[model samples]
Structures are given as C-alpha cells and as structure tokens.
Target: NFATLPIVAIIGLTIATMGALTSLPMFWPLPTALLSASVAAGGLALINSIGQMAGFLSPYLVGWIKDQTGSTTLALYALAALTIVGSLVALRVSRSSAVKVAGPA
Candidate 1:
C-alpha cells in the first residue's frame, strides 16, 4: 500500500523518535511526483504552503488539546490519528487517475 510506510512511521513516532524521523522523509517527494510537468511547480507550491500552515498550527492545536484534556497523551493520539487519515488520503490520491502523469505531447 502507498500509505504503508507512512502509517508505520506514524506509529513509530510513539516509540523510537529517530526511527520515525528517518522514515518521514521517504514520502517527501510524493506531491511533486504526482503532478504533471505542466503544473509541477505550482502544485508543489500549493502543497508546500498547506504543509507550512499545518506545521504552524499543529503545535497550537496540540497545546489546546492538552489544555482541554489535562494530559498530552490524548493530544498525541489525536495527532497520530489525523496523520493516519492523511496517509490514507495520500494513498487514495496516488491511485486516482487525476494525478497520473500525462503522455508525451
């Protein structure tokens, strides 16, 4: 499955931090790879922007979850669940014809 490694990495995050960190890079090129050459740059830009936004907001979200729950455990679990959902979406995208590379013109 396309999401297999990422799902594994997410689970590893709750265990060995370094192992998860190393595996996380394995999917970094996925967004650009899914785009056709004609739209690669713009697609990558949008993807990067979204990623940056998530990175900026994720800590605040986790902190808020922690405040509401009085423990970081639930926050971490929520983050992990969200990450798994993201991976599944990526897998679906990878399978969809919309992202297939165009034939030579």
Candidate 2:
C-alpha cells in the first residue's frame, strides 16, 4: 500500500518538472517566482502522503463496516453514498463544516 507513495511522488515530480521547464521564462527572479520547482516538488510529496494514507485506510474501514453489518453489498453502497457526500463537502464547503460532518477526529 505504501509503495504507491513513491510512485506518486516520482510521477508528480516528473510532470511538474517538465511543466516548470517548459513554462520557465528567462528573467531575473524567474517567471513563476511564487512557485519554484522545489515548492512544487514538496506539494507533490504532501499529496502523495495524504493519498497513500487515505488509500490504505478506506478499504480497511469499509471492510470492517461490512463485517459489523454482516452484509458487504449494503456496506459498500452506504460507503459509496457517504464518499460522494464527503467529497462534495470536502471540495466545496468550509473545512470547519466538513470537520463537523466528519465528526471528532
């Protein structure tokens, strides 16, 4: 599961590097001064870490719910709905509200 982290980092870095180089402008401070290659690399690493943790935990949590419910199909469906709602909230709503919906962490 954790293996994906390295892969994501590699891929994200490669893409970001190519993008930066292609868009790189000849200037005193550089074109995209606000976002240097190092910062982009760090952001990619952060994303990879968070994604790996979520990927590892999501299935385990869903399986545990199924075991407790004694029905895998129902559990998956419930989880799907929850996932959709969660994604919507996470992407659009205030994080405070999302945390409230997510409950005490």
Which number leads on lDDT? 1
Give the TM-score of each candidate: 0.68, 0.39
Q: How accurate locally, in lDDT, is each candidate?
A: 0.75, 0.57
Q: Write the per-residue lDDT of candidate 1 for residues 1-105, one digit (tens) a residue.
A: 212598786776556567557656766677667777788888878878998999999999989987898877788788778877987887887678446555899
Clashing pairs in 1: none
Extract clashing residue pairs from model 2: none
- Per-residue lDDT of candidate 2, residues 1-105 (tens digit): 212588886887687578646532422222123335556566556646976887788788878877898766666576668656755654453333221123376
> Relative to the unseen true structure, what is the C-alpha lDDT of residue 73 in candidate 2, on a scale of 0 to 100?
67
Off by over 4 Å in 2: 1-38, 85-105
| Per-candidate RMSD, Å | 7.7, 16.0
